[model samples]
Target: MTVERTLHHFPLDPASRQVRLALGEKRVAFHEVAERYWERRPELTRLNPSGMTPVLVETDGGKTLVVCESRAILEHLEEVTPEPELMGRDLAERAETRRLLQWFDRKFDYEVNGLLLHEKMEKRLLGLGAPDPANMRAGREALRAHLGYVEKLLTERDWLNGRRLSLADFAAAANFSVIDYFGDVPWTDFPAARTWYTKIKSRPCFRPLLTDRWPGLAPVAHYDDLDF
Candidate 1:
């Protein structure tokens, strides 16, 4: 029997979803363990001391690759499976792509993720917090600033960082999809950003990811609409 590699990750997690997209792009078959972190799954904690998702466990060999960070897992996947390259094929292009990936992961996520996700989703999942109206409003405000940056990049190039659609696009697209679920993105304010995102969100590899859902939270009507 061929040993199966199980991916222990939350389907709705932006980063975890990125890994699933990457794997799906590569046509890699693996079992999914739908472990959400906000609920504080002990198994995820044990598997990764940092207690994060996107843990790829090679159950057959006991050679568990617990990727605590999303980017680490992405880098690992690029190294292991080079075909249909998501990151750039050359060293310089890959570096530039990674730079943008970090910028999106850190700058964009920090500015908006906590403010909105915490206010709208995390409180319910964390099971102890209440909705902070202030944070939600602030996140809505921050989206304007972030969208400007995305628009600027799209105006300069076809994609965010390099000429090709690299991991940077996936990273940013995932974050945008998360906020879009709450109907938080001020799309009309940034038509260029909206246009660029339309391309990324419509990619074949990203189709399944956009359909992801949570138990109590119904995604906005545009969630699965590729053109929207």
Candidate 2:
């Protein structure tokens, strides 16, 4: 039985991007449905009561399964399609991968995205006024700290979790890519992190994210440049 898959997501959403990267890396065929989740469309809410993006709906002939949010969807993908696993193989590796996943989804999102994305992308989409300079400054500072941590990790290992590419890489990349779109990442100051990013950016799965553009939002000139 062939399983048909459809993903509901927002173009610039980090969570959505994570799912997309996982699907692409796993070589899974799925359809994309872009959603403006902030609007809280009734249809979207029906799929996921929380009204978040990155919902995955899978149908195998008659039966259907709906997975909501990035974490659940990512775990579901790994469980259903074990080949080319994104989670690490061993227990320690898997634990580290999950820890980083939480770090990005919680700590990173709170310190960085909550302030930066809210001021820049959310405000523009919702027709709010100009970005708060104080918030932007704080976000940038926090981002540099995060990048320094990434550089440290890269110095020790090949990938974020350890030796192999894992979901941790996708999580960090998804968040960084969005910030990079706005030309905010201080890549020049973080050579190791830049090198790591360059390697992932060259991957086939990362190609689609480079091309994502929302109305009224323009990306930095080098956002899509693999060589940049």
Candidate 3:
């Protein structure tokens, strides 16, 4: 029996990107549905009252499952497909991965993506007014600080959580890809972080995101450059 999977996501949304990468890493085939979630589409609101995106709808032999929220979707995928374990190998490693995943999903989102992406991507898509220079400035500063911390962490381990590649790496990479789409990342200044991201970008699972395009807006020139 072939299971059908559909993912409702926004092009520039980091959370949506995260779930996409997770599904790809798990080698799961899914149909993509571009969503204007901010428009409060009836079908979306019906599925998730929060009206948020990255919703995964899966239909197996006789069962249908709806998974809302990026983290939940990732966990569900991991539970269903345990090979190439992304969370980690042991309890402690899993805990660290979860902690870093939350940090990227929450703290990083609040500090950087919340401010930078809103001004750069969200407003443009939503037809909101102009981008606020002030917020962009603040977000850039936060990004620098965050990048510095990431570099520091990479000095000690191969991946964000530890020696193994995990969800933490994907979470951070998803957010970074969104910011990078606008050429917001200071890749030259953060060599270590750049090296880390270069590796992530080279992965087969990351290819789909590199090809993502918005109607009028295009990704930065180096956004998909593996050598970059």
lDDT of 3 at 143: 98
Better of 2 and 3 by lDDT: 2
Worst 10-residue lDDT window, candidate 2: 207-216
Error of 3 at 183 (Å): 0.1
Tens digits of lDDT, candidate 3, 180-205: 99999998999989999999999989
Taken over the whole model, the C-alpha lDDT of each candidate is 0.79, 0.95, 0.92
Candidate that scores best on TM-score: 2
lDDT of 1 by residue, 1-228 (tens): 455677888776777877877877777778888887766688888878878787887544654455566888787778877887888867987887888788777777787886887778877877757888888788888878888888888888877766887888888888888888878888878998888888877777787777778898888997788777
| Residues 50-104, model 2: lDDT tens digits | 9999899999999999999999999999999998989998999999999999999
TM-score for model 2? 0.99
* 10 residues in a row with least lDDT, candidate 1: 58-67
Name the 10 consecutive residues with the lowest summed lDDT in model 3.
216-225
Quick one: RMSD of model 1?
2.0
Give the TM-score of each candidate: 0.90, 0.99, 0.97
lDDT for predicted candidate 3 compared with the true structure: 0.92
What local lDDT does model 3 show for residue 19? 90
Q: Please tell me which model should have the higher TM-score, number 2 or number 3.
A: 2
